[model samples]
Target: MNRIREIFDIGAGFENIIEWLTEEADWLFDFIALVVEGFLEGVNWLFHFPPALVMIGLFSLLAWRVAGKGVALFTLIGFLLILYMGYWSETMDTLSLVFSAVIFGLLIGLPLGIWASRSDSAWKIMRPVLDFMQTLPAFVYLIPAVLLFKLGPVPGVIATLIFSLPPVVRLTNLGIRQVPLEIREACRAFGATPKQMLIKAEIPVALPTIMAGVNQTIMLALSMVVISGMIGAGGLGNVVLKGITQLKIDMGFEGGICIVILAIFLDRVTQAFTTKDKS
Candidate 1:
């Protein structure tokens, strides 16, 4: 049994191949880093552009409009708590990271999902890939991400994007597939072009499901953003990490409460959007 296991041991070979690729792929990594950095910078600037107070006011108003008074109150309290805890900047940084990941994830995943919906072969190919992405331990994404982009928000964003992408694609595909065949046929009978059918009939109906997917993507991105801080992503996660390193239980708890508050706020807002669309 030992001899047989030795014969099949490919770990060394895998390591060697990875080492070779890492050495040879410097240019690829550099290019990716440049693009990701640009995106991160842009999102960071957007999040920071308005004074924090103004941003908070706008967000609170949006919550009231979309999610109702209860959620708006919660949003106001949550932001205030984070600000009072002196983690406002870190919270903003985390938000920027999550938003950037969602933006990129949607840009790529939505098109792929739509394509898969239209082609059986494409769906077949995408299924296993999405399964692999979704089923893989989230931490595994950071390994290659760190290798490629090194430590910082770049790698963090890359990891978050990869980790959060599968849900959007899968949901988008499911949404389109779930559309009633009768509706499709009626559109065809009405002489609707494929583009027109999709834009007019299919997408409108699928919007709720797609938005649910977007919500999931955002949540997953937020979770990954926190974990990515282990690699120096620098956000509320960093504060939490610092608390852990220093054995500051109160600090850790404070950071954790802030994270939970933010999560609830985002979850409520997205869910509200989904519910509103459905209604």
Candidate 2:
């Protein structure tokens, strides 16, 4: 056992690789920082630019439309409660982080998923990568994110994106690949191009599954908010963190309640989308 350990020296090997990457990948880090910053700014603006009341009304209307009156009412009351607790701004910041991560996750995950669905080689490559992403502890993502983006909401968003990305990709690939072979053959027999078959038949059939992925991704992003807060991401996570440090039970309770409310609200809204698609 000692000899095998000495021969392998996995820790040393891992450390060496990390050191090499850090030394050689400065440009890559800068590029990621730029892209993350752009997304962070856009999402932040979207959540922050409008007055809080207007934003609340808009979200309430959206919840009503998507999830029906019950969810809408809950959303209104939840937001009002957060506002009354003086955590409105923090909640908004958390929402911004989540939205930004989801948008980017979808943008990247969907295409990769589609590609993986269409090609055996791509699927093989992505399978292990997705496994690694999904299996790693969520907090581990924050380290690279902080190193690349140097903390703040950008790092938070990046970490959240990494953590939440795999489900969508995996589900999208599953959904598309699960398309009935007979249907695919029929489309080909009808002289449909690959693109047409994909656009008209595969994606539509697969949408429900994809939407489920979206719901999962959003939930994962929300779960990461507090972890991200540790690295200066701010938001309700920060409030919770403060409460933890100061031993303020009331503050912690308020933050926890708000987080739960937001989670339920988002889960319902996204699930509604999936339900609508199925209907």
Model 1: per-residue Cα lDDT over 1-279, one tens digit each: 889767776775656666776899888879888988899999899888888788889889999999999999989988988888888889999999999889989999999988988999999999999899988898888877777788999999989998999888988899999999999999999999999999999888998999999999999999999999899999988989998999999989998998899899899999998999998
lDDT of each: 0.90, 0.90
Find the number of clashing residue pairs for candidate 2.
0
Candidate 1: clashing pairs of residues: none
**Which parts of model 1 are misplaced by more than 4 Å?**
1-17
Q: In terms of TM-score, how similar is model 2 to the real structure?
A: 0.94
RMSD to the hidden true structure, all candidates? 1.7, 1.6
